[model samples]
Target: MTGHFLSFEGIDGSGKSTQARMLADHLRQAGRDVVLTREPGGSAGAEEIRRLVLEGDPDKWSAETEILLFTAARRDHLEKTVWPALEDGKVVICDRFADSTRLYQGITRGDLRGVVDRLHDQMIACEPDLTFVIDMDPAMGLARAKGRQGTEERFEDFGLGLQERMREGFLNLAHEFADRCVVVDGARAIDAVAADVARITMDRLSPDAASA
Candidate 1:
């Protein structure tokens, strides 16, 4: 874990994916090695699992089943993609990680947060060095997510109510993991949000960070 691991999280359509990519690009331009990946699907095996979890009907899988699938995918991702990159001291910017699971499948449908945590500790014990929780209004975020017209709309198809709950869940998660979490308002212009992310990341990467 010599390299920095970063993750972006938010309710659906919170522009976290975009910010993750922007931060990766920013780091790359500064001559740092960057590996931008996303979870539920970062490696080959994980990508296959991603389609299973992200596509199809909203009820295709139970919350319990989804947790298993996500944890398995995360395990594969770490073995095949994340660990190797980190071993090489590359910046790994992930679009989503275990946090998303802790929300989407954990608290949203039931009181499975404990289950998710236990499985995460047992199977995928990785957490980002830094996490950016993008904050956005649920309704607006849902609209943006729907606008994508992508097949990965299974979660979005869960509708506005789910998004609303997820928003609150993510905000609370930021507090729970405050040391490594930074909540960024995502309602602003893309460049503005990106700029803030870049600055924050650079500050964290600075040699003085430990002192600061």
Candidate 2:
């Protein structure tokens, strides 16, 4: 219960991957036992699911189906890797978690409230000690995402309107989990944003502000 489980969230356009790694690197430098991993991944089984869900160009899976895939991978990740890492007292840094399901599936899905409620209540109860939601525009996010290596996956390429709704969903999530989540401006320079993230994480991890 005293271990730190931190998660990073944002739309595809948001620079969470960069910031998450930056934060992890910063934590490592400070001598913290950090475990950096991402969701829909982080294990062999989950990686296969990630490939199918993200890389496969499929129009068959509905929103609910996608949500189910994510949670399945999530449950595997928790049981096989994340939970063990936490028990070992490592500060776990996850790129995405159940939140993505709510944003991508809930907001844009046909049954928004229902999808959100089910996942919130039934699936993910072990909320992170801290969750940083990097906020940015969908158009800009897709552009930034495109700049990353390789071609856009099915999810990354989902249009700007979908991205906007995803952003709104994360914002609402932030409001709902204000004590643990803080929306950091991701539109800024990558290094500047990284610095802010590091600062926030460091402050929270500091002995004097351990409960932060």
Candidate 3:
């Protein structure tokens, strides 16, 4: 319980990945024991799942299949990477976790609430101390995504409508986990977003996360 786990959530092109790395670097500079990683791609087995998932199309991946794949990856990541570090009191910064499954696979793709919950219980059920939801409009978000033409992954290849629903998914998640989630405007500048994240990091990890 002394260790803190923070997750960065948002639609594609919302700058969450960037912010996660930046925050990790800041924490490291501050002399914190921080271990940076991402869901579905942190461990070797999980990363392979990432490839399968990203390459999966809307028609190919059923809701059940997607959730199963996510949990499989999550199990490997937790066992191989996340839990061990957290046991050592390291601050774990994951790019995305179960929320991504809830959104992309559960909410957007179709209905898999039952499946998602069951898998979470079965594997990768750790709740984060805090989750930063980088919010943004779908169109604007996709425009930013288009900028990454060369590196677009399967999930990042979602169309505008899918992106929009994902945005809603994120918003709904922030609402559902209000006490454990912080919503930031991803539309802001990188440093600006980083500053907010840094301030939050200081507030929580330091003796002040619950205070100013």
Say which candidate scores most in lDDT. 1
Residue-wise C-alpha lDDT for candidate 3, range 1-212, written one tens digit per residue: 56788999998889999999998888777677888999878999999988887764546677778788888898999889888888887889999988888887777877877778777876666888889999988888888877887443566665788988898888988999898889999898899999999888677655522222
Kindly list the per-residue Cα lDDT of model 2 for residues 1-212, writing each as its tens digit: 44578899999869898888988887777777778899889988888888778875646578878888888788788878788888888888999887787777776766665766676677656778889999998889878777775643687666677778888889999998899898999999999998888778767664632222
By TM-score, the candidates rank as 1, 3, 2
Residue runs of model 3 more than 4 Å from their true location after superposition: 56-58, 206-212
The models' CA-based lDDT, in order, is: 0.91, 0.80, 0.83
Worst-scoring 10-residue span by lDDT in model 2: 203-212
Q: After superposing candidate 1 on the true structure, give the runs of residues whose Cα lies further than 4 Å from its correct spot.
A: 208-212
Pairs in steric clash, model 2: 13-141
* RMSD, candidate 1, Å: 2.2
Tell me the TM-score of each prediction against the true structure: 0.96, 0.90, 0.92
* lDDT for position 118 in model 2: 75
- Top model by TM-score, which number? 1
Q: Candidate 2 — what's its lDDT?
A: 0.80
Clashes of 1: 0
